[model samples]
Target: MINNFIKTCAQSKLSSIYEELLDTSKQALAVNNGNIAKWESAIDELKKHNKGGVNYQPPYININTSNSDTKLIQQSLKKLTPWRKGPYQIGDLQLDSEWRGDMKWDRLKNHIQPLKEKTVLDVGSGNGYFTYLMALSGAQIALGIEPFLLFNYQFMSIHTLINNPPNAFVLPLKLEQMPKEAVFDTVFSMGVLYHQKDHLLHLQQLKTLLVDDGELVLETLIIDKKHGKQIIPKDRYARMRNVWCLPSTDTIHTWLKKVGFKNIKLLDITKTTPQEQRATHWIGNNTQSIKDFLDPNNDKLTVEGLPAPLRAIFTCQK
Candidate 1:
């Protein structure tokens, strides 16, 4: 996959830093992990099957193709379990992931600039569902960077099945590891900001990735101002320990402005519900979804007593 990405990058705007990008991605994926062999075996099994054509079929990023060994494919996919960001259709099998990404895509797709022939970066892209959507939207190249090794392998599994895979690829690289180059025409930072210990720095790093007048699509968990400016969870938020901050929409707007982003526009703010995030067999043993994370007695708050998960999408120009 990295070899294919290197070839694609050599012909695109990313040609300038493709070497650095490739080196960094190689190092990131080279980390010692016992599961690497298992994940590679799954991808290898998936590669034996035929490839398919990709399309958008509403809730699913549909892939039209056939596989003689549906059960074998399913079992192989199960080896790379805990799919979190998609509800994809490959041939006859519906790999229902934890999050229905189409819901989030529909909310902001029309609002952003068209991706035709543009260079795009998807930060923290889990398994490249949206990254594939971005590429299908006609981007010259849509590069997804995810730090998790498993998600990168999952992306490769899916990529292996695409008949004529789009100029879409995922690398096991973090936002901090990226070359600080103003090359991408559109940069998407979704579900990533709050994890940062310094929210301001995250916004700053996002800004540095875009070219002059380039667009940025920022999405992350936020709180209503009525709750306070922002809340730093003492321990956990929504059953996840990595969450660090949940700012009000207004507070996030202020942070964007502080980072010198121009024409910052808050595009959408919607509370996450079971329909958008739910458990399925793809999520493995950690079947706990949004409903399980929320307070059973009161839907308005999480089990940890923080406000229910409300997310905001903001679009701005660099």
Candidate 2:
């Protein structure tokens, strides 16, 4: 299984580096159960050859002895619920509106019942809004893993209120950095997988974190239609230059099946307005030119004039 997984990864020309890391990970898993000291030695050797960004660090939190300051911070977070925006809010950072509305609390509750007495993992849990919601919904324990430093602190403080709140621990690490022993009954990832350069590796890591028959929820952007020759958004890739892979529905479905996810269901709930009105929101003299291509009645937006726009929400059993 490991060999086949590696081969599949290698087949994607853009993901060869990740494939090598996956191969090394299999070796680490083999020795991980044998000798602790030997495993550390092997890991050190692998680090020396870490040409790819595949090597992941362990997740951890920072602590200070200032009790009064920490308490004040925690209190501030407690008073800030019923947030109107998405899971993130620090000074003035925010994601798109579609993300906030897609798989929202009302919709999410319908898909997943109250997680009473169940362990849950919120992957990419920015600012811990959903984490707190899960706790309030009676989850036995909710663990959040967010890589962003500032956002992790916000989540940590808010999560601390759970009446022994299900270990609202926030680790400043990515999904791949989590310890193999950390497993959960339900895992949620929103507005995250699309940002990864190696989407397949991200999926596999999520699978490893799940217990038998666990549940997974994911939301991502998909290609709906093709537009010939489009320019890349300069601001989109500013955070991470490698986050450029946006797969079609067919491609993503196949990848999910290949990773062993069962009973996969894809739901479409996209929003689009007519080009003329869309152009009115545009700025400057370019408005007229941009408005010419607007087609509100069009079923989908074209990507690079070759593919269609198709955003989807996915749910499956791991």
Candidate 3:
């Protein structure tokens, strides 16, 4: 499948970076894991239920078909559970994932540039949910780069069910692994910046991948400026150990200016809600989510005494 992606990209303006991406993806998939085989098997099962095609069904990326074995489809999809980033629907089966992804889409859809016929790069695209949306919006190509092998398999499972999947593709690679190129017309880095140990470097990398005047859509955790310039969590923020930094919206604007972004615009500042991210049966053994991570006495703060999950969306030109 990846080989076919490389070939398909070779005929486009992205041919220069295809070889590097192919190499990085090969190395990522080579890692051994107990779940790899299981995810692959589940994906194989999903392939059997392919129909004519799929269309963007608003909150649900619905596959269109006259008939389907819904029972088998549900059972097969169950094997790859703990869905974190979607609330998709396949025919009659509603995959009410942990996160209501459409809510995030609705927040920023009207504020950004149109994606039609543009090459888009989605950094840290979990399971290619938004990547699929980008293609649905008529992007020439929407390429998602996710390091997790399981998520890549999850992407394939969804891809196989569609007869002629859109130009969306997910590869097992990170922003750092991508070959330096200014090919993408738009770049998105959502729910990824706080996890980066070096936030500036991540911003720089995002800038490098876009063409001049290309817009960047950045969404990440942020704190109120009244709480101070920023907060570096002592151990964990909302029980997430990898969270390194949470900047104020003002601080984020300063960072963008320092990085040479022009015409920066703060789009939205919204606190995450229980309806948006909560524990669900699909979240596997560890069903904990935002509710569990927050302080029982105070929903405004996390269990660790830091500010609760508040995210900001910003757009700027390179």
Model 2: per-residue lDDT, tens digit, 193-225? 777767888888888877777777776655543
Give the Å error, residue 23, model 3.
1.8
In candidate 3, how many Å is residue 157 off?
A: 0.5
Q: Model 1: how large is the Cα RMSD against the reference?
A: 0.9
For all candidates, what are the clash counts? 0, 20, 1
Candidate 3 per-residue lDDT, tens place, 217-318, comes to: 999999999899899999988989899999999999999999999999999999999989988877788999999999999999999988899999999999
**Candidate 1's residue-wise lDDT over 127-154, tens digit each?**
9999999999999999999999999988
TM-score of each: 0.98, 0.54, 0.97
Model 2 C-alpha RMSD to native: 15.1
lDDT of each: 0.92, 0.49, 0.88
Candidate 3 lDDT for residue 303:
96
Model 1 poorest ten-residue lDDT run:
1-10
List the candidate 1 regions with Cα displacement exceeding 4 Å: none
* Candidate number with greatest lDDT: 1
lDDT of 2 at 76: 47
Q: What lDDT score goes with residue 101 in model 3?
A: 90
